[model samples]
Target chain A: MTMTNDAQAVLPPVPGLEDDDPPQLTPAQKKRATSRHLAFQGGTAGKLLGYFGMLAAVLLFFVPLYFIVVTSLKTHGDIYSNPISWLPNPFAPENYSYVINEVRFDKYLRNSVIITGILTVVEVSLGVMTAYGLSFLRFPGRNLLFLLVIASLMVPNQITVISNYALVASWGWRNTFQGIIVPLAAVAFGTFLMRNHFLSLPKEIMEAAELDGTGFFRTLFRVVLPMSWPTLVAFTLITVVNEWNQYLWPFLMSDTDAVAPLPIGLTQLQDNEGLTNWGPVMAGTVLTTVPMLIVFLILQKQMIKGLTAGAVKG
Target chain B: MATVEYQQASRIYDPSRPPAVNRVSLTVADGEFLVLVGPSGSGKSTAMRMLAGLEPIDEGTVLIDDVDVSELRARDRDVAMVFQSYALYPNMTARQNMAFALQNAKMPKAEITQQVERAAAMLELEVLLDKKPSQMSGGQRQRVAMGRSIVRNPKVFCMDEPLSNLDAKLRVSTRAQIGSLQRELGVTTVYVTHDQTEAMTMGDRVAVLREGVLQQVDEPTHLYEHPGNTFVAGFIGSPAMTLIDGATVSSDGRALLGPDHGLDMDLPREYAEKTPGQVIVGVRPENWEIVGHGAAPEDGGASMPLTVRLVEKLGGEAFLHCRAQETEGMTASVRGSQLVLRLDHGFKGIEPDTTIHVRPKPRTSVFFHPENEINLEYL
Candidate 1:
């Protein structure tokens, strides 16, 4: 009797049981009891701790963005004051215009748009085609080809920069749009992402399309691609962001502001002499960062949905 | 409509392992409904896939309308397939889904819409024509899949366990609907299923397979009454036929069964003449008749003692599960040495663990060869 009482004390009280009754349960009740015992039941204290951790993370990321905006709106005198100002004392809205006129921000913005546009279109199209070939098309040595594609992802871009620069220079493409966009057009990351998504789609649907008299390219464009909107949007956003902030390859390729992107153009705001104006540089940084931020904000939902697809099933 | 023929078609997935579908040859007359039935891994679905051109025919030729189509692509073969999962396009509306094939064939806009609307009306899916697959229920999606095939007017229809996903009640109604619809359209079809009941009820002629080999192909009633082998005998019936092994023919034209010849009865004259040394006897549940409690048979027939194990009362009829009391000389291959007897629904006063005597009705016992398990009547 005493041992039974001790066992009862260790077990949690079941919902519909009387306090005085012995704990004889049906199979369903026993299953519920075992799952309740094994699962983590977060109480009020754990929930509070979770909220506190989320608050800390939000503050950690938000503070640097706050500083960039505040410094971009501050005058040179306010920036160099003995005590740092979290808020601008004299709001200098002229810094944006000054950077736009003096630093040729308009020309840099145009070049950035043109380069990122062409790069994203080419990269995404090539990635979709390559991924479709790897996944759906049958050929000899197909597995070996896919393995090589995955292997290319492991070799860092920095390792290929010097050789790529030499090739571009030999072809007389230096300081040109082709020199910057052509070398980076073949993206292994986008191909890998799209290949996995394509593989997750039901193979029966593809067979159904084939029975409907659709050829290879029609099936890809009509059936396979229409159902792949989320992943396609995600790949496009990633490609745009990557090409927009690309600094190294573009810097190596471009010798002037004529074909350089936003990241390469941002460096021209900094003076070689020590007495450089800090206001316009910060304003130019803001100008370069905001467009990508807007694009991310607009496409953030689809990006997350695409990345998490196939992780859960109904 | 076109007749379909398979001339030793086979599909081998791996070189070292046995074929997924061994060489099978059969013919389906135009407008005939043929069902392929088997257990899992029995290659029923694989055979139908070969007909649909979804699976490669590694060994032989498949001809539709007297044209060899083994080398034809799936689209070129012009066969319509309804997958087990329905396989509807989630992004397209029901109208678009049904009209997809017509649009692919470059039909005019007016004709595509007209055919889609006609199919939707026939399937009672007029309200669902504007909805996507994700917004529809399972039965609705299944109807859309049917409509998709109907609008194509293809040469042959290949259905792979299409009704295996619905609820029990819905499966019954939809199966009836599909049967009547096939007759109305008079299209040649090859259906695949693992349910013996579905195969018996739906197919004009049923084909049974085992271990990637074709076992028997006959009309439903003929297949039931005359099974080619022990596998079909055991697999066809609901409660399954009980097979008793080690029974032998006596010197006086009587068959002796059980330990010490506890049960003996005269065999039919034709069967007794060809009887071998040892044979296996098969008796279905409905053929067993109750005599008395441990009493001699009044009709001068073979009677064996049975101890009741359990009774299942299923409203209209009751089944008594019994263990043969004198199974000492029976071979080990006899399934559990158990006997099943079907009784009327009003059967009363028979409880578990009671001993009773039962006998097979005249001319109801079928014998099989001991080694090969083939029906001796046919031999």
Candidate 2:
């Protein structure tokens, strides 16, 4: 009886406060107001301090990018100069053109585009379906299978290199797109991400569809798939970035210049010229990350939502 | 619309454990509105899900229009359901959500459009058809759910506490809307809710379930006036009916009158015959006519002594909480009217320890067998 009374006592005060005369802000609210005032007020010095802090953080990130851009713009003589100035004077457009027209940079760019594009498409589509199959569909050993896939998360790419090479040699798929592209497909992280994404959807939604006479695949396709776009886009961006800058896997798989992507091509140039063709090397690096940055800006909304959805569940 | 008959339909989740819904046999006539009412984990949801083909039936047959639906897949079964959560497709617009079934069936684009428009108009969602589920309010999303089901025009409409998610005021109005809409469509509908008010007001017949068993199924008035057991007796009414343990005072296969028992009445032979050991008496609040002070015991309208423990004065009628000295543990609700004798006013005037005496409404009084807990209604 006292338990009920205590529960009742906890509830009635809320109603009492609601029904009370216009509330005067208490000391707690005053403290909150004072803290907010300190952050916002204290005149010009506070505003300047806030701006300075932001500027310092921005400079910390921007310095490396500035160094890369300046190195790309300088000539070989300018790069080897005793003192490195913050700015590059007498900038040369020849470095960009030389990397573009003379160094077979176009082939590397084209190869990178094809490999990344094909690999991303494979990874996202297959990952989503695999996730859907494992998450939504019920089969035998589903828990064990998911655990196995999660187990794969801990296995580094190095562990698979020898076994994958043996398989590639047996298939005679070396220097082939299949060898390069297929190995990167069915990534475990993508599968796990989409599975977790599907898991986060309200179970009531599935029950509702079931009661509405929707089939298992229908529910997955109509309800589950449509809501999974944010995850798909995030997975796509991640795979693109991974496949875009790939060096070791591509280098091991493809031997000829025909299939060598930008990373390998730039490494080859570094080996050949050593310190002389630093201009074109820096230029290629700049070119590599520019498209990634551009793509990120376009789909940043979906990426952020997908990333945060796992943490903030329904 | 169709009649649904569940013949020994039992939903046993774990074979070792008891069924969630055990051996439920009931028939819902075509176009009859039936509401299944029970608390959480009472298997009302399990029963609705069984009817919806969301839960598998373990032991019996569910017949829709005399065709067994136990083997049928949910899509082929064609039973539309509106969920409590309103499970609208979050990504699609309201129109698309409503038209999803038709699209899945490979209907023509024009036909799908026409059906979507019709459903949107019927559900009053024409203005909001372009909005996604996230953009719509609770009520609008509920209407969209209704639209999705209405487009299918299934044989029966099963709703699992559809209005439980709405605000109080919206729940009241939506309850009326759903009731009228169910009648208008003339579909055999099975609605589930824990609220007796909803069960009483919206259902043509209300079925009360408890803990995986069907307690009673009857018309609202009949169920209210007559319950099958003590469970139904207490669960059906508000300000729950209080029971005086028959073991405490009953004697010689008969109910003993308290010292202030004004209305001297004998128990009917059925209760006295079966329940000599212990009997549970059931009475609603409105049954009692509050007696005035110093009322004679043997008068035509027999009166018992009572202390007005608490008074709640409503505009037309009021509730008087009276306590009997014989059983200090119990409280009785007496009607508030102009009594022959006046009572004290003001909250400060009433004493917490004061007593009251009142007679039960013997004509409407019911006695239940304490062993089986079955109410023995006098013929």
DockQ of each: 0.30, 0.31
lDDT of each: 0.85, 0.77
lDDT of 2 by residue, B136-174 (tens): 788998999998998888899989888888899999999
The residue pairs that clash in candidate 2, if any, are B305-B357, B306-B356, B306-B357, B307-B355, B307-B356
The CA root-mean-square deviation of candidate 2, after full C-alpha superposition on the true structure, stands at 6.7
Off by over 4 Å in 1: A1-41, A301-314, B258-267, B293-302, B327-333
Candidate 1 chain A: worst-modelled 10 consecutive residues by lDDT: A305-314
lDDT of predicted model 1: 0.85
Model 1: how far is A141 from its true place, Å?
Answer: 1.4
Summarize candidate 1's per-residue lDDT along A1-314 as a digit string, tens digits: 02123545478678777657687899989867777864545777997898899999999999988877888899989999988988898999888999898878998999999999999989999999999999998999999988898999999999998898888899999989999888988888989999999998888899899999987898898788877878899899989998998899999998788998877767888763577677778899999998998999888877666445422111
Candidate 1 falls in which docking quality class? acceptable
Report the C-alpha displacement of residue A259, candidate 2, in angstroms: 0.3
Question: Candidate 1 on B296-335: residue-level lDDT in tens?
Answer: 5567655677889998877667899999775465332346
lDDT of 2 at A270: 75
Off by over 4 Å in 2: A1-56, A211-218, A274-276, A301-314, B247-254, B257-266, B269-271, B292-317, B320-324, B327-354
Native-referenced Cα lDDT, model 2:
0.77
